[model samples]
Target: MRPSLTPVPLGVEPMTRSILFEGLFVHGLPRNEAFEAELRQAGFDRGDLLPQYPLRLFRQCMDIACRHFYPGLPVEEGRRKLGHHFVQGFTRTVLGGAVAVGMPLIGPVRFLKKFPEHLRFDTSPILVQAVEVGERSFRMEFRTGVGLSPHFLRGMLEEGLRMTRVNPTLRVVRHSPISFDLHITW
Candidate 1:
């Protein structure tokens, strides 16, 4: 069984962009009544999600998606697959046009250097720090408490770099309640 979510602090409500949900539902998962009902149980109404959603809800939604779509897989593996699909789904959406066009031109090295800034462009109120450790590698540290699995991040980074025509290898070097580090090399 997967561990429960860390409780959000009182009076601090972090939110996520609805575009993320749009990517998940429209591109990653089949949109059906069953999926919609599952989202509702996780405190989201698929049809009603609009400009933004609670960050907690987003995490729960991702977990639910992983469970539904990868029931036979381990939790970590399922979330990783979900993350990989999320990038594919996200880039196909109209809102993700910039990513589709910009990533190829930027290349993996440059893209990794600017990942933190680029992330802010799409998702706000989350803190990520990217440091270039070598010419062909970098370390991304999640500074704020995102609570996202490192395996999931690995999949996302792998797919994002793959879009630039390079395959990236990623691993979790450090993990804690408030932060985590992913070392990525192409």
Candidate 2:
């Protein structure tokens, strides 16, 4: 019998925290007072979120914000929006500059091919498996081990492709409680 998997709390890298806050600010959300309240309700505080802390609190805070910001919004839609916002926010960082430098040379296909190496799994639970299906197409599967919602993964993948200068089409080929697969074609 398969052992019961204990859900692990994942860490949010500094870059991710920066992206999330920037995304919230871009959306015109009150990132200070309101966000603090949300964090408190989610069992965390500003102190707890320093740089590289477990993301459970942040995820919980986002969930609360999603409900408040977009009342009656579908979870999937919220995740997608969050994903897009994350990329926008990420683009303003130092790492974004490095990625931009490679845009002209690497292009989206090669970037996606090497995307998995970008994730810092030592601090986070997110894992990615990329399978190249064609010259400019691929299937990327994210395994979060129940730490994150699949819809969020879908959105991140979609926007990441777009940032790579590709007008890619993304389809959710599969989804489950712990993982999801996205088929991307440029």
Residue 63 lDDT in model 2?
81
Return the TM-score for each candidate structure.
0.85, 0.73
lDDT of each: 0.75, 0.64
The reply for model 2, stretches above 4 Å from the true place, is: 1-36, 40-49
Write candidate 2's Cα lDDT for 1-186 as tens digits.
Answer: 323433454552412443454443333244567756766666655444345334565576668767766557887788667766666666665666566566657778777878787755344556777889988889887776545655666676777777667788788755666667888888
Query: Evaluated with TM-score, which candidate comes out highest?
Result: 1
Model 2, poorest ten-residue lDDT window?
A: 12-21
Please give me the total number of clashing residue pairs in predicted model 1. 0
